[model samples]
Target: MGEEENISVVVATPLVRSQVVTLALLFLAGIVNFLDRSALSIANGPIRQQLHLSATSMGALLSAFSLAYGFAQLPIGPLLDRAGAQRMLGAGLALWSTATALTGAVLGIRSFLALRVLLGLGEAPFFPASLRIVREEFVPQQRGRAIATINISTTLGQGIAPPLLTLLLLRAGWRAMFAMIGGVGLLLAAAWLLLLRRESSVRTPPAPLAETFAGWAALFRVPAIWGLMLGFGGVNYTSWFFIAWLPAYLQTSRGISIKTSGWLAALPFLAGSLGMLLSGVLADRRVRGGAVVARVHRSQVIVGMVLSALSTLLAIRAASLAVAMACICGALLFIHFAGTSAWGYVQAASPRALVATVGSIQNFGSFMIASAAPLLTGWILDRTHAFAGSFLLCAVVALCGAASYILLVKDSLPLSEA
Candidate 1:
């Protein structure tokens, strides 16, 4: 009887078992995304030595990735609406993976910058494709959990990249690490082509490309949505900047050994992974329970981001390594949770048919702004030789994200155009 009841509940829910596999693929793909992003960080030591780069140059490389990644967002949504997730994302994965491997062969900052730009171009479609998949594959109420599960990639990849890639760097050098990641991407892309192609059909069964673009009209008119975008953009700035430069900072300012820095970097990412899974469950329950779902559901993430911002400041201020580590962990927890909410907002605001387009633009804005943060921060560090000031810059960015959410977009779900 109990088994039957459980089956009934599962049956009634939009999270079909088949769809779970689809989400799992999405999650794994996301893991691949971050691992690719972290290739530079994991290999920073050797790359820096090989290229003899200044912090500003390193920062420019990261900025180039963001600049390309940001603009790439524009076309992705429209294409996802037209071509479907399997083909668009599969092609994107191939492009970015190849770009990552190419990074290993680059001779200088200009080549490195060019490769990163290409990498961004290939990576541009990921979130939009995922958004389309979830909307077509899962129910609205179930999206946060599915999105959360997909988010595990961020937690898992970021967590593993620091330590795992570090080991590869130690064993084979940084250039080799890029090759390793690229190889993994090739394998995953093949797997996606074979196993996940079946799931892509649902994302855009009969949806017209024109209809998807038309939906953006509503998005542009929505003030609250802008608030959400601005807030999340702030969070992304801090999180992405830290991701881009933290390794160099640890190596130069914290006086940590290379292997040790990898382990230390793993701490925040690990905390963030746990936070992603936890916040997803919590947000779902609160939303279903009859509370003001909009304000409260988003609050789970907003509050997390706010806390993350505060911890970043604390991390920058700490005099001791232990204190700094503690604060970094604190900030990381919020970053992951904030993602849970930010992505959740995308799930909510986007109509079932137009989700990919909405998600693409939103994330595009975040990354567009993000392109500058790393470059600016790296330049500041190079010029000033002060880690605290760079981190202070980090704190301010996160605070901007928190304020945008609080003051402007305070809803959990988008208004349906009935």
Candidate 2:
């Protein structure tokens, strides 16, 4: 389609609604999604103390969510392609919100673990659905900015969660905090369903069962698919390491008070949010100026990963708290640049019919590798009583991700092959 026709279609369609209501709702949903995800980490100290859990146990608790979220992608991807983003995401929003609210009622590790798993399953559809919308609704050149706009919520939610949840934790207690966020999510879910209720579902015609399986097998054979999976996994490992453990790291390692740690933890994520915006603008501008889609996005991811790795490595060796915080902020900023670029690349590279499938496969690999972050970090902390080792591991993973994108991901997935 021509650019003018694409613009007119977007303006006329409810799928985008001139890119106003849809993007706004998606942004809000993204923020709520991260807030719900971050609640456990924000309240980690109180929950661990009340439940009498060790670092190792807490790590396992965190991994429970990642494990479920990761595996769910295997099925959720195809389901989204078949069912549609609006229906799938709306249902996921309600389910996860209910699970988040129910978490407050858990009395022990087992119960909490179960709720976390439920939360993961509910959340598994989020990015795949969101990215599929970007692929289908936005024109190719606009997708970088669109993807980045949605992604900013991830960091923004993380940035705000510490302070917001901390205040709720102090005033109403962690249980009340969870209940409140869950309520907000339930409201958002209703709004999402209402917003998209009149729109036709975006779906491909159902293929026969054998054809569906064959399509999946073909996707598995694509070299770029594997590259995207492993590269994104490296990105998530570093990001989740911080998201899952940064606040606790501040309080335990720096001897900072819980109240102080909340604000301190927000800084890096704020930087991350800024980095995503910058990367997105740069990506779209370059692509509009006739840059190759894969080359532009791939170079951004590679550069961001390398810088993030260096920054993380430096953070672990900083001599003062200020220096450490600066380095951490830099690390987050660059990693988010990589994260946003990776998503943009996925949208630009995948066949339209397989965007969600490709994205979900990448996500599956990401969370599966990322689940190791908390578990391994906690294990290291328990034995050595330091976070330096964990940070080093993240730095290494970032470098490896850069290498994977460089060596393996070269071109878009061919529709015929897929």
Candidate 3:
């Protein structure tokens, strides 16, 4: 019953306009977030040469962002629960935008790492806050689609970033690219602050400090929360591999030029975006048709992870660049299908009072391991000098994620009520 207050919504006619606007804004924010991150990977080749850095050192820079993103979640979660998503996310947007702009001014490795950390900290609250907004604004049936729609922005941003950032890099250089993106972020941040203030959506009121802390304590007693964290962490290890290293892998291992790789790199992400959108529709339909929520969500994840693994393994054996790209696309499509289901479940399983807290934990867990993906991929690539080993490693990690979800997460259970 307590859970229903959060998960169930009667989509009134009057609410439609607000919901649409909210989703659109969130989608834009998602794009900006991913674009900022992906720009670094797209320009990594030039950055490495200019900085005279090894693959390992470049990997460290990438990991630094993720590490800060994950660590910030612990504190940010409580802050969001207290302060509200709109304000917190607005502040975060401004901070990260400044950090992104400042990236253009980095003088050395230390300054580079510091700014990346700041960027991570600023971006850390965006996803959890977005989930909270979706939970507050949409009915359960609509939530999956909303989550998927927003997540598609991630893929869209990734898909666009390679060619977009590469073109900018070629024209104005990497520093100018960062500055331009930062400017775009500032405009988006302003929009977020302005438009969101006008919408009247459902929100959980802040509880007393003691009561809120007590709720946080109770959350730790729920085994499913821990299980969710572990399962998602495994998935993140593989997903981050694509996010941080795919472009570089395409260029270095496949012998593609940077320009060609930029276009080719867009394929997998575009496929992933489409897959996420489909999963949203399917998951909502499944639930609306009276399928058990736990079974539907968990099964989606398990099946998706298995397919992702198989596709990735097949990618290494592909005979041509086109075939390899197709394989990677298939892999990402399945992975996003699984990822969307998992996020949908977060809303379905959480209590209304603690949705953001639960989501922050999920993000923290994923990024903790995800932070390692770049470093590990770089180390492996530096040693093996081929993409095959990295692809194989991703496949294995996806399998482990599947196993974790199957073993630890119970089918069709609302965890907050536990």
Scored by CA lDDT, what does every candidate get? 0.76, 0.86, 0.82
Candidate 1: the clashing residue pairs are: 294-412, 348-414
TM-score quality measure for candidate 3? 0.94
lDDT of 3 by residue, 1-418 (tens): 1243222323423348888888888898888898898878998999999989889898999999999999898777777766678878888988898898888888889999999999999999998888888888877667778899988998899889888988998899999999999999999999889878643356577544215566666666767767777777766777788989988988887899988888889889999898899888887777766665546777888888899999999999999988998999999999988888888777776666566777788888888888988998889888988878888988988888888888877763354354
Give the C-alpha lDDT of model 1.
0.76
Each candidate's root-mean-square deviation in Å?
4.6, 3.4, 2.6
> Candidate 1 has what TM-score?
0.91
Which candidate has the highest lDDT of all? 2
Candidate 1: segments with Cα more than 4 A from true spot: 1-15, 199-218, 412-418
Residue 105 CA error for candidate 3 (Å)? 1.4
- Residue 186, candidate 1: alpha-carbon lDDT: 81
Tens digit per residue, CA lDDT, model 1, 1-418: 0000001122225556778678777888899999998888777767777889877777888888888988888777777776768778888898999998877788888888889999999988888888777777776568778888888787788888888888988998787888879988988888877886664545444334335446545566666657766776876787787688777778888899889999888888888888888888887776666444345446876788888889988887788888988898888888888877777766665455666776777788788767778788878988889878877877787888788777777454344531
Quality of model 3 by C-alpha lDDT? 0.82
Candidate 2 weakest lDDT stretch, 10 residues: 1-10
